[model samples]
Target chain A: DVKVTQSSRYLVKRTGEKVFLECVQDMDHENMFWYRQDPGLGLRLIYFSYDVKMKEKGDIPEGYSVSREKKERFSLILESASTNQTSMYLCASRTGGVETQYFGPGTRLLVL
Target chain B: AQSVTQPDIHITVSEGASLELRCNYSYGATPYLFWYVQSPGQGLQLLLKYFSGDTLVQGIKGFEAEFKRSQSSFNLRKPSVHWSDAAEYFCAVNGGATNKLIFGTGTLLAVQP
Candidate 1:
């Protein structure tokens, strides 16, 4: 079984503070993704990394960025956390040519 | 552009009753369809997937989904609903050569005792 683990299950930060959400996968999948989920809006992609040091912006990438320094770890960074940035953040990893993605238990972020 | 739509936002079903959640997609070619379940405060879990060959695919927790090419629909169904089955269900589609998945606005299911 593929196991994706997130660094934090819940977090709270003040406005304008920097926030980091970490994700690690044991399967060494080539693709890693960061998504923010909201009510009635579903899961919207924030950023994705296809390989180490390679990143692409997804649909909603305005206030978010990503880092993939190693093969097994992906991190999402918020330059300046705002109240609107509070959301349930999910991390997923999948191998190339496979459509199935395994997800980690999400981090519920609260930016006050 | 490929998109997925889940019409029903919330559904209520009694325990031991039948349940169905609708999903429709718009893609140019054959699409990869998936149904995922998210429990409260948890990440999404893959319930089932439809790539090819089989129209009706079985998934974990006694759930199943059928893909109808004619209608562009991949609806999920369960013969008997349990209280523990209450969760938010999402439908997603992967079309073309992209690894990205377009997810639908999820449907929250409520199981009554």
Candidate 2:
């Protein structure tokens, strides 16, 4: 079974703070994704990386960036955390040419 | 552009009852379809996927979904419902080109014993 592990299960930060959420996948997948899930809006993609040091902006990428320094690790960075950025963050990984994504336990972020 | 829609926001069913969650999509050509379930405060898990061949696909945890190209619908169903099945379900679609999935606003399922 593939395992995707997230760095933090829960986090709280004040406004204007910078936050980093980390994700690691054991499956050696080629693609990783970051998403923010909000009530009623569902899971909106934040950023995705196909390979190390390569990233693409998703539908909602404002105020957020990502890094894929290594094949197994992907990080999501919130440049300036705001109250509106408080939401559940999910990380998913998939092998190239395969559409199935394996997701990590989400990180619940609260910005106050 | 590819998009998905899950009409019901919330659904309640009794244990042992049959279940169905509706999903609709808008895409020009053959689209890759997926259904995912998220337990409370957890990440999404793949329930099933449909690319081609058989219209009906079986998934984990006794879940199955059927694809109807004419209606552009890929609805999830289960023969019997269980308390553990209560969760939020999301539908997603990816048109061949982009490699990005478009997700629908999820449907929350509640099972009553």
Candidate 3:
């Protein structure tokens, strides 16, 4: 099984604080993605990295950024933690291309 | 532009009953279709995907989906529903050559005793 692991399963941060959510995959996938999931709206792409240090913005990337310093690790950074940024964050890695993506357990972020 | 839609917000079925989840998509040319399941707080897991070939695709956990080009629909179905089948299901369509995926509002499933 492809194992994608997130650094933290639950996190709490105060407003204006910077938050970091980390993700790692053991499958050596070339593509890594960060997504924020909300009720009714589902999961919206935040950022994605195709290769090391290469990132692209997704549908919702206003206050968030990502880092891919290595092939196995991808990190999501919240510039300033706001109450609205509180949600479940997911990380996924795909081996071949866009077809199949394996996901991590997910991190529940609470920006108070 | 590309998008996905899961019409049923929630569905309840008996443990031994048949299950079906509807998914509709909008995109130009042929689209890559996928169904994923998220159990509770876990991340979404790929259930099955349809890129071409057979319209009906078999997946893990005894699940299957059929794609209809005319209707632009990919519906997931299972013969018998187990209690463990309860989960939130999401439908997604991949558009762009960059691997950006558009997902639908998920459907929550509840299995009755």
Best-to-worst ranking by DockQ: 3, 1, 2
Candidate 2 ranges beyond 4 A from true positions: none
| Residue-wise C-alpha lDDT for candidate 3, range B42-104, written one tens digit per residue | 989899999999999999899999999999999999999999999999999987777688899
The runs of at least 3 residues in candidate 1 whose Cα sits more than 4 Å from the true structure, single-residue gaps closed, are none
Kindly list the per-residue Cα lDDT of model 1 for residues B17-45, writing each as its tens digit. 99999999999899999999999989999
The DockQ of each candidate is 0.82, 0.78, 0.86
Report clash pairs, candidate 2: none
TM-score of each: 0.98, 0.98, 0.98
DockQ of 2: 0.78
Instruction: List, residue by residue over A25-105, the lDDT tens digit for candidate 2.
Output: 999899999999999999999999998999999999999999899999999999999999999999999997647988999
Off by over 4 Å in 3: none
lDDT scores of the candidates, listed in order:
0.95, 0.94, 0.93
Cα lDDT, model 3, residue B71: 97
CAPRI verdict on model 3? high
lDDT of 2: 0.94
**Candidate 1 lDDT over residue span A1-112, tens digit each:** 9999999999999999999999999997999999999999999999998899999999999988889999999999999999999999999999966469889999999999
Candidate no. 2 TM-score? 0.98
